[model samples]
Target: MLLHIQFSPEPIPAALPALSLGSETGAFVEFRGFVRGEEGDHTIGGLVYETYQPMAEREITRIAEALVVDHPVQAVRILHRLGPVPVGEAAICLGVAARHRAEAFAFLASFMDRLKKDVPIWKTDTLPAA
Candidate 1:
């Protein structure tokens, strides 16, 4: 079981779970959440994220661990950006490797949902300049 969770100020790396792939891995799914240009009626410029690193990392690890145990996955890599993230920039990336595409897809989507709701990370939306 391969698991990696990191809170980075830099952008999420393009090559992540690619390196964590195992011999039994047959399917890989990567999901990225970006700072959108708009949030509801508000026009967003970017976002500032703050987190209690120790606690947030632990919570994220728990989510990943549950994913591996609940699903048939070979590996899971989760990365979240801290500080400022510009619109269109990726804020979160989740990668999952499994023996089949269905499990990988399901796990990736479910993991992302869980991360957003359960993780201790918080984001402040920045409104666009007037």
Candidate 2:
């Protein structure tokens, strides 16, 4: 499952049952991205994420397809947020499920890494200009 990218000051969705317990698979893994307190030499008060929607979605779909083809994972769900996000809030969330624990873990890790490196999302700090 994929989500429509959104930008809101409100908290991210609390219920991700489709990712957690929707599948009958024996294993599930989740990855969550949050706002950090620092970025490079700058202190981050918040973050703003922007994406070229069409391109970003396409890239994400490609990654998901690759994961299913290359891994034993049974299903995958990815969600990402945009706009102003404060510290401790989730920027992205990923979930993978499989029949075994090992595959679930491995696929989740790989997906996270690939998303960070390949996804078209861009982030900018909301810190005050020096």
- Measured over all alpha carbons after superposition, the RMSD of each candidate to the real structure, in angstroms, is 2.0, 3.2
Question: By summed lDDT, which 10 consecutive residues of candidate 1 come out lowest?
Answer: 13-22
lDDT of 2 at 65: 73
Candidate 2 C-alpha error for residue 43, in Å? 1.8
Model 1 RMSD in Å is 2.0
Q: What would the per-residue lDDT of candidate 2 be over residues 5-44, giving only the tens digit for each residue?
A: 3434466776676444444578777778888887778777
Q: What is the per-residue lDDT of model 1 for residues 4-83, given as tens digits with 9 covering 90 to 100? A: 78789998866663634657778888888888887777887888898988988888778777876667788777788999
Superposed by TM-score, candidate 2 places the C-alpha of residue 129 at a distance from the truth, in angstroms, of: 11
lDDT of 1: 0.80
As a whole number from 0 to 100, the lDDT of residue 6 in candidate 2 is: 40
lDDT of each: 0.80, 0.72
Residue 61 shift from truth in candidate 2, angstroms: 1.1
Deviating ranges (above 4 Å) for candidate 1: 14-20, 125-127
